[model samples]
Every structure is written in structure tokens, then in C-alpha cells.
Target: MNEADALVDGEPQFWGGCEIALNTEPLEVIKEILKACGGRLFEIGGVYKLYVGAPGLPVLTMDDGVLRADEAETAKPIRPLDERVNYISGSYTRPEDGWITRVGPPRFDASRISADGRVGADLDVPVVQSGKHFQRLQQQLLNNAAKERRHNLPLPPSAWGVEPGDVLQWTSEHNGYEDKLFEVEHVTDDHSLDSVAAVLEIDHDDYDFDPETDLIEEPDGVLDVDRPAPKEVGSFAVAGVANVGTNNTVRPAVSVSWDDPDDADVTAIRVAYRIAGQVDEPGYAFSYEPAAGQLLIVNLQPATNYEVKAQFESFNGWATETTPWLPVVTPDIRFSQNDFNAAVNARMAQLDTASQAAIATVRDALVNDLTNLAHYLLGQIAKLDDQDQAYQATQGAAVNVVSEEVVTEKQARAAAIQSVEAALDDAAASLIGQIAEVDDKHNALATLFGQVFAENGEGAASALFRLIAHAAPTGVAARIALEAKTAAGAYGEDSAALFLDVIAGVGSVATIKATAFRVQTATGFAPILEVQDDTVKIAGNIGVQGDALVDGSVTASKIAANAVTAEKIAAGAVQAGNIAAGAITANKIQAGTITADRIVTNGITQSDADSGSASGAANGTWRTLCTINIEKDSGTRGVMFLGIISGSLGGSTSQSAADIEGRILRGTSSALFQTSVVATIATGGAFTIPMSVGFRPGSVPNGNHTIRLQVRASIPGGVTIAASGYLYSMLPRA
Candidate 1:
């Protein structure tokens, strides 16, 4: 990457990592990375550059000479400002909990809504942690969304100097544009048209964001919702038509049937019903368990009209809206014979009146047609008679021929009248037969009514009503729909099909009690969740949040390998006795979990401790005594350089001293611990000087290091140093 690209690429500013799944498209991964940093990748002059936050400073100014004067007057917008994206929403990983939580754009008074209202786009920065960096990301995204106005500016060849991601200043009087700054999204050259146009969008900068002042609200969560309500009151209908209940006393009733609310929180349903127009009267109410298919509302007045509606109750509160009121009219207790007869008679009379009216209309229309035909025949006869008289005056023999023609025409008119009479007679016969058929049906209905309204209470109608309305006999219980069962099963209640069985509890709160709950997987059955009288066992993976308040000790064998992470254990919660011997190896101990003070002396193994002996003699110049190379793992630790130097101390002059030093070298840095042995005379048999050095390199880079003992004499007399050194490396707590 180029130096400039790397600077704006957010590598140093926002430190994070993302897990890339296999088979993920390279372009998608690149896009997500760029989005996480509020950056954009664009190609300029054959080279690709990734701009992290915003475009660079303005490169040039476009005025009359650089821009096409006439084209600028009709400059077209790349997209209407109102149609550009504004609101942003998406998911990001929360560092504290490692949960992928949804986040919305930061609130800013200057932010604008698109034409369609709250037009939004998702900016998923799943790798971002919940902190100031995440807020800054949101701020940058909002600022980018605010820069929605982009216009296509026609420019001269001189404007070609502006490249993509370059901000440019433009002054125009045509569209009332002042000395406004715009970033060049891209520039297009048309050789054929001899024109160059650049797409310029409003530019954003550091001035648009103020980390200290702007709001950095928490991410969207479940509790952030103001008040959630059910999406729907599912499957509502009124049942039990034409039914009467006589459990304690006879009364008309209807069953309110409905499914559970779509919302899982809704626990029960409340129904209210009263006479349709009795608003001032007290209404009856009934509460049904959640998902109860049906409930009978009894004690209603016979033949009375009522309206009922249902409302749902959730943990949050009651639903804001209720189901629309449904109207129902109770059936009368009895029907008298006189009343039934009168109803049938009234209906029959209506049919008779309609039939008579239709017949009269047809009779009038036929009479008028016959009258018009007679008038036309009369006029024709008079004209023919006049022609016959004129013919007699012209020729006496023709007068007898006219008389014979008139006689033959009169005979044909009589035959036509006979045919019409026969057709009218058939229509009358058909009407009479229909009337007789209707009378026969009416007589049959009267006979049935007699049987139904028989004097005694043991009529076929009463038997039929009881047979249909009363509950079925014991063995045929399956024929009727099963009643809904409750969490506490009640006696005399019918069986029900349950989606989930809650063994105990009242109302909405419930507990699932089971000796063993076996889950079936593709492999086989597994008792993933089991409940005992005082203990619970889970054979599969389980997640626990917050502090685990264990009353009893958790055995080592019960805990799975790697189940308890460094973060999961509280500081100082684990003691030496709590850990089994050899249970924790060097590899198992996290770098910062254990400190020097926390580790017991015996915690250091033989492999980590080393000792060596060296004998050397030197005069004036420093001489190497003993050297040991120790390999250090990448962890926070400290090492001690310890040794004992004993040898003859001799110098050219009396009171001269021999100096011994212990040095620890790692990379380019070293620490030294020095001690001296003084001789009263020029020579001495031997002396011992103990040198110990403690180097607490808090967190040094990992590699092999050398610790050595060196000796030197003050004067030119042989100085001998025999040294035994030891090196111990220890890890410290985080």
C-alpha cells in the first residue's frame, strides 16, 4: 500500500480483527473492511486508492474558463438530493459481551430524511467494538449520508486535472451555487462530444464531527423499545349459534373462539360482551387462558342481541387495541304454531301479489296490441271496399271477383284467432298447476309443525334438540372437539393437544419439571437437560451469563476442558488447593493470569531452573566467567541473575580490590549486578562475593537470552573468580 493510502486506511487508528469465513467472496470481504473504517475504494488514472474517512483537500477551482459556461447553466444532478440515502442501520459486535448487536445512526439535528421518508441503508461493521471508535464510525457514516447532493458538472479539458477522491471548489450563479466545496466522485471524458464532465458530491471533513460534543448513544437493544404490542390478534370468530345452556338455569349463550395472540408475551385473553345498545349497563367479562381454542359465555337473556370483543394481556401490559365487536342474537326459547303459520302465510301472500302484478302487466300489453291490429284491419277493409266500387264503375264483371277475395281473407282471419286462443289456454293451465304444487308443500309443512309442537314435552323436536346440544355419551367422547387443558390439569376436563408442556406454575409464569429431558439428534437420543430433586445436569453445551452463584464446590472432573477461560475466573478466586497437582501445565497457564507473588516457590519446574560453574583468572581486563542461555516464552515475566564468586584476590598494590559482575543480556539491553573483594596484602588465598540481580522486564519480546558472570582486577595482579550461577524465570499476573 502507498504511504498515503495506509495513513487513511485506519490500521493504526482502529485496531480490530474479523473472522473471514471460507468461500466468502473477495469483493465482499474487501467491501466490509472498507465499510468498517468508513472508507471507499476508487480507481483514479489506472491506480486504485482506498480513502479511509473523507476525500482529500480541494485540488483546483472551476470558474468560467475551466468550466463550459453554457453547459453549466443546464447542469444535471447525478441524483436528486431528496432521493439519496439518509438513515443507516446495521449490526456490530459488542466487545464487552461478544454479542452481535444492532446499531442505528447517531442523532444529529442537521441530518435530513430522504424523499420517501427515513430511506435507509445498512452499514454492517461487525468487527467494531462498543466504544468511542464505534461512535466515531457512526458519526462518519451520518456525515457521509448528509452529503447527498451530487451534480454532473460539464467542464473543459483543463478540468481533467481533477481526479477521483479529489475535492474541488466551484462557483456558479446559474443554480445559485456559491464557492461550495465538492469531492469529485469520478470524471468522464467524451472525445467524440469534445466534453468532460465530473460527478461532484458534497465533501465532508473533520469539522463535521466533534468526538466530545456529539452523542454516542448505546446500541439498539430489547429494552430500548418504548412499548411493544402484539402484531395480530389471531383467528377470531364467534361460535355456538342457536345454542342454550341449562347447567344451573336455562339461558342462551355463545362461545367466543380465538387463537392466541401472535406475540409470545401475551398470556391470556379478556373478552367483554353486553347487549348491543346497552352501553350504560354493566357488561360481562371472561378471561381465557392463552391459546384456549374456545370458551362458552352463558347467562345471556333469551332472544337478546349482544356484541362481544376480545383484548390480549401481555407481560408489558394490555394490548392497545382490541378485536372488533361481533354481533350475535340469541334464539327464542319456543316457537308457537300460530306464529309459524302466520309467517308462512305472509310469505305466500307476497308471492301471490307479485304473480298477480306480472299477470296484469302481460294482460294490458296484449290488449293494446290487439286493439292496434283491429284499427289497422278496419282501415285496410275500408280502402279495399272503395277500390271494389271503383272497379264496378269501370267493369261490372270485376265487382263479383272482389266480393269472392274478401270472403277468403275473412276465413284466414278466423283461423289466426283460433291459434291465439289455444296458446292463452295453455298458459292458464300451467299457472294453475304451479299454484297446486305450492299448496301441497304448504300442507306438508303444516303436518311437520303439528308433530313439532305436540302437546307433550316428549316431542321429536325436543328429542332432536337434546340429542344435538347435550354432551355425547362416555365412549364417544372423541367425536367432539377436546377442551383446552391447563398447566394444572383439572378433573372432568377433556384432553387437549399441547405444543409445549409446562409442568407447574400459575398464570403466565411456569416451570418445566422433568426427571430427564431427552433431546433427539441425528446421532441418537441424549439427555441434554435433566432435573433432579436438588440437582440439574446438562449433557450438552450450555451458556451462562453474569456471575454463577454456586453454593457447593464445582469439582474438576465435572468441568469440561477449556470450559473455564481466564476471563471467566475472578481475580484471586482460585487457590492452590483448588487446583489438582499437575492439572495445570505451562501451556495451560495464561501469560498474565498468574503473577510472581501469586505463584508458590515450587511452581518453577526443573526445566525452567538452571545452574552452572565457571573458573577464570584475569588482570585489569574484564574476563568471562560463566555464561548460560535461557529461552523465554512470550509472557510477562522476570528473571534473576544469581551467583557466588570465590577466588584468590591479588593486586600489584596493597588494598587493591577485585570486582566481579553478573550481567543479564537480552537483545540489545543488559542489566548488571557488581560486588568487590578487597585484599589487605598483594595476594590472598580466596574470597567469596555473592552477586544477585533481579530483572523484572514487565513484558519483553520473546526469544533466547544470555546471563553471565564477568570478573576484573583493580591493579595488574592475578584475580581469580569461581562462580556458581542460577537463573529462574517466572510469569506475572495481568
Candidate 2:
């Protein structure tokens, strides 16, 4: 057991080793059906640790898989992964016949990085590759890697003579240091230190600096260390295989299914899958909530055996139990481009869809809590008010102010007993965490929310509220004091949740997010509202804030509060119920459908006075209420009408036969619409389309909306009915 015995290990265990003649059966014939991608078929009953070679490249059975080693035993015409596909990826070595040639030396990256604490990136990514082929191949691979930025190693760290990023390394006994296994830091003077080294990275942090931090350590000393040879849990087979490709690296994979018998207390299931037959790769760790009982395997090399194991971790008991599962046999796959793209795209989309809805939902939840908070504040104040009055009358009316002060001074302490009578900010955060524990996904978000930008916002709001809360007078001032606390709490809960929701929602997670943002003016900048209560202003117009939705009739960037009309509407159909609900308001009233006992049409003008137009009447320049705006001038501008259509601003512009447009029609009311033509088409800074149509008070005949126009002038080339049309609703009975 000296030098000769030291050269070998594992008791010369051979499971699938033999020299079978090449042909078409259990020899070369059987291999044709047995060889798998990134692997060769080993003899079914004879071998383990066999030596072999595919043309141009040796398809080494460094471990096991190849059934035989005889050249005659190699299969005939089996499809293999293209070697080109493995070039930069180092996925597979390809045979001369376009089959994936077997690859050895997974530790090749070790050579460039272990010389002198320096990773030699300057070392060319070596290959037997030709210049022309490599150039085209490298570019494509680069693009692929670029698209997968998540997988890209961090850009090398920037520093003087060193870096703190991913560097290739290997463990090997160097320079007869008594078999001290040192991490390869760099290749010194182009010398290969050993024929059997495995890659590893340096991970030591030396803190004590003897001379103000410049104690020079030799290169070999920095990495020098002894480690026993790594043990190999030799090749095994996986059972019940499923999906792969969760990662970009090529590896063996198999499906696994198991359950925690004690389901009520479990929190998560952790799985580790790793490729075998290599000395360099590390296994991956993936954890899933107990909720995802099943997981799909991915990133596997076809026909390779991947070792997989799952551990169930329980939240209730804080214990983890492991389960042993079978190995998988990766099958040879030749996928069509379209099929591949389609499958991967669907997988990626699945990752994005759920998150898209989550943001809006969490936002709505915050808003709901805020609203509830207001309701709670009202309840607490009423209770406090009643208490104050009861004590005042019962004790002495003379002590009203003093007694009130005493009550409030004691309120926070007293309220702390009942349901935390803190300010709004505190109340809101309490609710978010309170709600999170109700759902698993919600709780996970809460955990992530805490770890990421800590709800410092809530903390900040609480801080601000406490400042205001503590500053108030003790007695009568307490009521006002508490409100500030409540408001602060509300802001904290709202702002923090909103911030996190926003980041998580972006980046393909959320499809749509709507928020009402108030504009804050920069210091020294003053904005004035020219139109009082204006909802929309010109794009460049200076104002307090812009609209969250689309611009209305104006191109203005901001809108002044309460300026827009209640009569104005967007895409939705205006309903009769809305009139009673207080949403409907107009300067004049014209009853449409009389669904009630009677109808009241106050100041209803004759149909001839109305002018109703559609989108194209003025060639899309029309903005409803554009003319009602006094500041600007438009070609379609005219006198403002309410109860009914009105004639033009000019008396001479009216034509009795001009088409009259119908008013918006309500349910059960079809509207017959028509429009009056432009009295005259004017030049620069002006133009016009004077149109109108009307119906019986509540009976809009078409129930469909139309621009009923009366041509009073040249009526330039009559308009044609469009492919798509518009519809509307009549006014509710008044």
C-alpha cells in the first residue's frame, strides 16, 4: 500500500467496464440506443470508470455512462449535441461527425487564476477552435450571454492591482509543500503545476495589519493549504425524470416528489440538484414555500444522471427532514428553434404574470387600511368626546378646561390598553403586518419588505407624528394632538407599502399601476393657476401637478383643482342613477328618459339651437368644451349651449335646414343625431364645423350617438360613415 497502491482508490470497482466490439448490438449496436447527450453509453452489465474517445475529441467516461471503450463498440450515427453549441458554454465537447464530443478537464479554468493572487483574464479562452469559426461563434455566444445579464458574472471589481469579483481557481498540491492543497491564483511563468487539480476560489479575510495595513504576504503563502482529496459519491441513476433548464449551466437533472407528513407545521421545502461526472461544478440550492409542493427540474444535460434530494423545513417545529429520491436519465433532445423559443417564452411569462396583479392588489389594500383608519379615528374621538363631557358635568363644569387636559394627558397611556390609540402612522403599519400573516404570499412580501428598504418610512412617519403628538397641549389640545399622530401613522403605512409595491411592480412584474401623485414645487419656484379649478392645462403650462390619466380637452401638463365639469365624461356610459347620485350637474337641464313618474326639462331650447359633433366633424381637432374655454381660440368655437343645441355666435350663420346633432342617449332612449356644417371655413388661427341634432326630451332615437350637422356653406366633400361608430346615453329624467 505504498507508491503503487497510492495511485488508485475505490477497490478497483468496475460496474460497466469492458471492451465490446463495435457493430450494432449490445456492443456498438446497443450503444446506438444507450448513448445520451453530454454522455456516452457504458456497457449495460460490465463497466464503471472506463476510458474512451470520440473522434477528434476523447469522449472520456471520467466516471461512468459509456458502456464500452473499444473503437469497434462505438455506436453508429447517433445524434449528439453540436460541439459548436458547447464552445463558449463549455457544455459539451463535440465529435468530428457533429455529435457533441465529450469534454474532460472541467478544471481547466484553474490554470489561469492561481499564480500570484491574480486571475489572468488575458489568457485566451483556449480551444482547438479555428479563427473564422471561433469568431462567428464567440459573437453569437456573447449575445446570448448579454441577453442573460442575470447569469453574467459581476463585472470584474475595480481596484489597484486586485479585484473582489468571481475568479477562477483550482485546488492542487504545489511545489512539494507536503501535499498542501493550495488554491490556484494564477499561472506563474507558464507552468502547469499538476495534472489533477480541481478549481476553487480564495475566500480568506485577513483583518490585522501589523504595519498600518501593508504587511506583504508571499503569493504561495496566501493560498497555501492542505486538504484531503475530495470524496466522489460516484455515479447513480435518477428515477421519474421531468423538466430542466432553470439555469443556464449544463447539468444532470431528475424529477422528485415528496411530502411533509406533518403538513400543518411546515414552512418550506428545499431541494438541491447537481450534475455528476465533473470535478468542478457546485450543486445549486433552491427553496420553495411549502405551498409549491411540486417543482420542475431544469438546466440538465440530456441523458446524464443528476443527484437530487429534497428537505422539508417546518416552521412550527423549526426542524428539517430529508428525503432520498431517484436519479434521472437525460434524454437526447433536438429542438426546433420555434418550438424552443415558444416554450421558453411561456416559462418566462409565467414568472411575470402573477407579480403583475400583486402590486395593484397590495396598493388597494393600503388604501383600504387608510380609509379604515379614518373611520377608527372618528370612532375614538367620539368616545373621547363623550368621556370628556360626562366627567365635566359629573364633577364640575368649572373644571372643564383643566379636567379635559387631565383626560388627554392620560389618553395615550389609557388608549395603549384598548386598541393602541397611537397616531395614524403607527396604526397603518400595525395593520400591514397584521394583514400579512393572514396569507402566505402576503407574509413573504412582508418579510421581503422588512429586509429590503426597512419600513423606515413607517418609522419616519411615526417619528414625525410623535414630534407633533408630543408637542401639543395636554388637555383640550389632546384631541387635535392625536389626529396628527393618526395622520402620521396613516402616511407611514401608505408611503412605505406604496414604495415597495412600486419597485416590485415594475420590471415586468406588474402590467399596470395607477397612483395619485401630488406635485411638490421646487424651492423658490412659484406656480399660479390661471383657470380656477382647471382639471387640465397645456403640456408646458406651469402648475402644481399633472393628471395621472390622459389629458382632457387641453394639452396642458397640469390641472388646477376642481376646474373640470361634472357634465364632462370620458369612455364610460353615463347612467340615469348617476343623476340622483350627485355625479350629474349642468348649467341647464334637458330631461332625456322619463323613467320616473314625471319629467322636468328646465329651460329646454328648441332642437335648432343645438350643435352636436363627432370625432371627425372638424377632422379630429375637436375637444369637447374647447369653445367653452374662454382663453383659447378654435375653428369649431361657438356660443355655449346647455338645455339644447344653440345657433352660432353670429346671427347670420344659422340655416334652418342644417343638420342637428343629438344629445347623449341614456338607456331605453335611441338618439337620432345630426350636425350643422361650418358656417364658413376660416384661415390661420381659425376654422369651423357647426353641427346639431336632437330628439324628444328623453327619446334619443338611435340610442347611438352621432354628429348631426346642417351644411350651411360649401360643406367641403360630404363625410362618409366610418368603419367603426360611436354610441352614447341619454340624460336621466329630472
Candidate 3:
């Protein structure tokens, strides 16, 4: 047989191995021969050959309608039958398992098999090392098995040759047969005289194949088969509007809810919002996952309407259509500007009323005092007139008598008249001085009250007027009245001037009141007079008619010596400046309530404690360390001294110590009280001794007395005193 036929016949000569007669089929026998040669069998040019490491063979491609075979001869074309296989499936034997066991898990193209049946179930006899490699091999085998037609083409006699592992390409003029490429499975050449041509069996290479490298390139533009398709976005809507804060410029947040597309390709939703009429403001935008379909849009204008929109994105660079713009409005903010103005106006009006009432009270008090003074002066003048009339009558009778004795009597009467006139003149002078004093007081009060309510250029009246204008936009009458009142300094200066004129005897009280208000009657206008009676009554009722008057209108000069009793003064009205030095005796002060705070200086104050320190004494001796001088007035009934004495006493020997004593003494001589003796033996070794003493020295005489803390140790090596010792005295309440 020829060499190609001999190889196909499983000849032992082709492979250097011991071969016995094969009882298997022809294909099986050929496979056995190839296995023995450590190669695979391939059929080419109607002959079978052994192809060792076929995957590692150089690939060939068509060049100018010719096969550019690598390390092989040129390629030739053959007519292929239009045989189509509907289904392609593959199976492989696991290399780890024995050759008898096949891979149980089968892999196949379901769509292809459904249409083509099991005709394409092909066994891929590749020794796959792993399931993954097996799968790849199966895929390739399945693709190859699904080819429509495969042919064994005879090579032209003019060509050098072709090998089983070479690749070839050519075009066929046959109907439906166009340009095609193939891989030469096997090549064969017969050397006998009758055999002239070499034949090649080829499989379709529908995919790009690089023969020189034996690698397949996937078809151009093929997508990543593992990726999923893009999904369309679903509808979204605004949930509700959240309450915005009260600030005008504060941003608001709107809540939104939507359904997730549930698509693998959908990564997130793009959300954006803008105010309804302010689209140009370039509002906010954000992105969120489809799973979290809800979003909060923030930094929006308060009390403003807004529109929101959403869209979905996909893996394939596709964006779904945006959802419709949803309408939403932030909550309305409260506290408008007008409301604030109204509140301010009401407050100012209340304050203005109070200030007016205070001024009226002072004015009326001064007027009442002036009226009382007027009545007194008038009655005194009337008394002087009666005395003058009586003297005139007496003088006339003396003149008519005309004798020596009568003359003498007349001279005596004249002398008496002179004395009486002198007394009257003195009385008049005193009344004039009082009138001047009252006038000064009235001027001083007027200046003070003027400063209190109307001096700062923004007086109570001016402020009230402005507030009234803002509060009552349409109340012209009210606004005009406030304006007029403010212009007149809230009637403060006018009232003060009028009262001053009346008290200075420039005008009568009735005339002054009428002239100030331009009233025809003695009584003032209702608004001015309504408060007059109440305030005048307050002044008039200050003291009983028989009692000496003590009121705000009464100056210090007018008060009699020692007239201001405790019952006559209000609590807290007696300030420090009002009382003379040493005036507040113990009787004047509530006992025990005279705290250290009441004494300004030279008392046991906080600073005294800070500046003082504890002192120690030697054995059998007393040390007068801290001395406090307490001021007691005449009526003081009880005095108490309290403090703590802290120190440590050491004895030279254990049994050499007696006791340490702390005593509180009053004045220079009296030992008011003492703490119980603390045994010095107990404090022998680096220990502290604390003694607390509270002493009441009965009723201390009314004078400045010295109080002392005396410490004595019976026996001591050395005594160390802590610096926390302090003492103070207080008056016990009666």
C-alpha cells in the first residue's frame, strides 16, 4: 500500500511500537495506532495521518487567493456539500478519571438542540485537566460539529503540498457557495504510479484563525456575553412637603418616593429639583441607588413652590427618560413683619402710660404743697391786718386823751406796736425764704423728671408715637394725639413750668392751671384734671392734718429733728446716705439680721478671712492670734462668736503632753466661752486637731469690743496650725 494508506491502515511500520492484530472497527484501530504514536488521527486528501500536538501547529491564512501555509505546502480548495446540522453538542472524558468513565455533567447548546435534535451529539476526546478547560474545549468542539459541510479536497498536481494541520481559504463559483475559510484536518499523498494528486480534509474556520500561532480570534464586535441588558426606568412621584423653619431665607426639604426598576443594569437614579418660577436658579441635584428609591431635596427656598424630576442610568451607556416634574410647596413661614411691629407698639404704649402717670404724680404733689403754703400765707396776712387795725384804734384813743399820763401810755402802746411789727416782719421774711426753697425744689424736680422720660431724643413719647403710627395704620386721630403729646415733651416741661410759676407767686394755682391748658374754668381739661385729683389726693393724704408733714415734697430742711421714726419710713427707703454715721443703733436694726454684708468696712469680711492665717502656741503658754473688733450699738441684746481652730500638737515624749485649749474671748478681759480640751497625746504623731467653738457673751455693752481666738497647749514639742482657721461675730435677734 502507499505510505498514506499504510498509515490509515494502522501499519506497525509507521509507529515504532509492537502492534498486534486489531479486532476493533477501522476508526478505533486508527485511533489506537495514533494513540500509540502519541498523536491524533486526521484525514486529509482521502488519507489518514498522525498529527502530534495539533493545537501547537502553525496556522495558515489565505494570501491573494493562495494558502500561505506555515512550514507546509500550498493549499487547495474542494467543493463542499450543503449539509447543515441543526444541533451541536459535545462530551468529554475527565482526564483524572479512568478512560472508561465519561464526564457525567453534559454541556450543549439548548437552542441548537431544540431545533436540530441529537444528531450533532459529538464526543470530544480531549483530556481536560479541569471542568473549566473541559467547558472551553466542549464549546469549541460544539462549534466545529455544527458546520454545514466538510470536504476532502484533492490538491493540484502543480502545488508543492499541504499538511493535515494547515489552514486554507478559497471562493466557489457554485450557487450559494461564497468566499470561505477552512482548516486542513489531514493531508495525504500516494507514491504509486496511479496516484498523482494529494488530498486534504478540511473543517470550516468560520471564526478568524491565526495559523502561525494556532489561536482563534473572536468575531469582531461581539459583546461580552456575560453582561445583562439595560432596563427601563419606572415612574416616580413627590411624597409630601416637609415643614420649613421660620427664617425667611432658610432652605426647605421635600420628601419623595418611587418604585425601583429592579433591573440588573440600573445602577442609580438621578434626582434634581428647582423652584417653580426660579428655574434659572440652578437648584440641587443628587444621585441615589434604585433600591433606595426615596430622596430628600434640601437647600430649597422656604415657603416656595418647587418641581422635582428623576431618571435612571444603565450599563450600556443608556439613560432612561426622565420622569414628569412633580409639584411641591414648602410650608408657609409665620411671624410677619407687621405682626412684629404691632407687638413692639403695644409694649411701648404701655411704657409710655406708666411714665406719664409717674410724672403726673410728682407734678400734683408739688401743686398741693404750693396750695397749702398759699393758704398759710393768706391767713398770716389776715392776722397781721387785724393786729394793725387794733393798734390804729388804740393810737387814735391815746391821741384824743392828750394828757401827761395819756402821753406816757401812748408811748408804751407805740413801743408795743413796734415790737409786734418787728415780729410780723420776721415772720414774713421766713415765709419768703420757704417760698424760695420750694421754688428751687420744684425746678430741680422738673429737670430730673424731664431727663427720665423725654431727654434722650428718643423719649417715651416719641417712641410711643412712632409705634402708634406703625400699629394703627388708619387711626389718624390716635396718631395725631400721640404726635402732639410727644411734641409737647409728653406735657412734662409745661406742667413743671406752670407749677413753678404758681409756687413762685407769679400766678395763682387756679390761674396757672387755666393759662397752661387755655381753659376758661379754674379746673383743667378732663385728661389733665382726671389725674390731678387722684395725684393731689395722694399728696394731701400723706400725713394727718395735726401731724408734721413728711412727704417727697418735704425737703430735708423742712423735716424736724428726729421726726423720721421707723414706722414713718418704708422698708429699704432708709438708704446708707440717708442715715447719719452711727445713727442706726442696735434698736434701729432688726436683731440678728445685721449680717456682715451690712457693715461696709472694719467688720469680719470675706477679705479678712483671706488675709488671716492660723497660729500655733508653745507648751504652757497662750497665743492671742486673731482679734476681730465688733461694733455694738446701745440697744444690742445678744452677741455670738463662732469659728473653727485647726492644728497639730506634738509632744517631745509620749507622756509629756496634756491638752490643747481653744477659747473665744470678748473685749480684752472676758472669756466668753471655750471648746472642750482636746488631748494633745492623741495628736502626738502627725495628726490634726480640730475644735469648733460658738460663744454667746450675753449682752455686750454698746461700744466697739475686741474678740480674740486664744490657743494654749499644756505640753508641746511643736504645734503646726493649718491656715483654714476663721472667726466671726453676729448679733442674735431679740
Cα lDDT of model 2 by residue, 351-396, tens digit: 3452333333333444454445345445655677678667778877
lDDT of each: 0.51, 0.31, 0.44
As a TM-score, model 1 comes out at 0.27
Q: Which scores greater on TM-score, model 2 or model 3?
A: 3
Each candidate structure's TM-score, on Cα atoms with residue i matched to residue i, is 0.27, 0.15, 0.18
lDDT of 3 by residue, 362-466 (tens): 344334433443344345446665775577677886645665665565455445444443333332222210010112212211111111122222332222211
Candidate 3 TM-score versus the reference: 0.18
Between prediction 1 and prediction 3, the one with superior lDDT is 1
Error of 3 at 665 (Å): 99
Query: Order the candidates by lDDT, highest first — what do you get?
Result: 1, 3, 2
| Candidate 2 lDDT (Cα, 0 to 1) | 0.31
lDDT of each residue in 289-388, candidate 1, tens digit only: 6666577787667777888887776766644568888888876655446546766667677545644543443334334433443344445455665775
Model 2 worst lDDT run, 10 consecutive residues: 148-157
Count of residue pairs whose backbone atoms collide, per candidate: 5, 109, 7
Which candidate do you rate higher for lDDT, 1 or 2?
A: 1
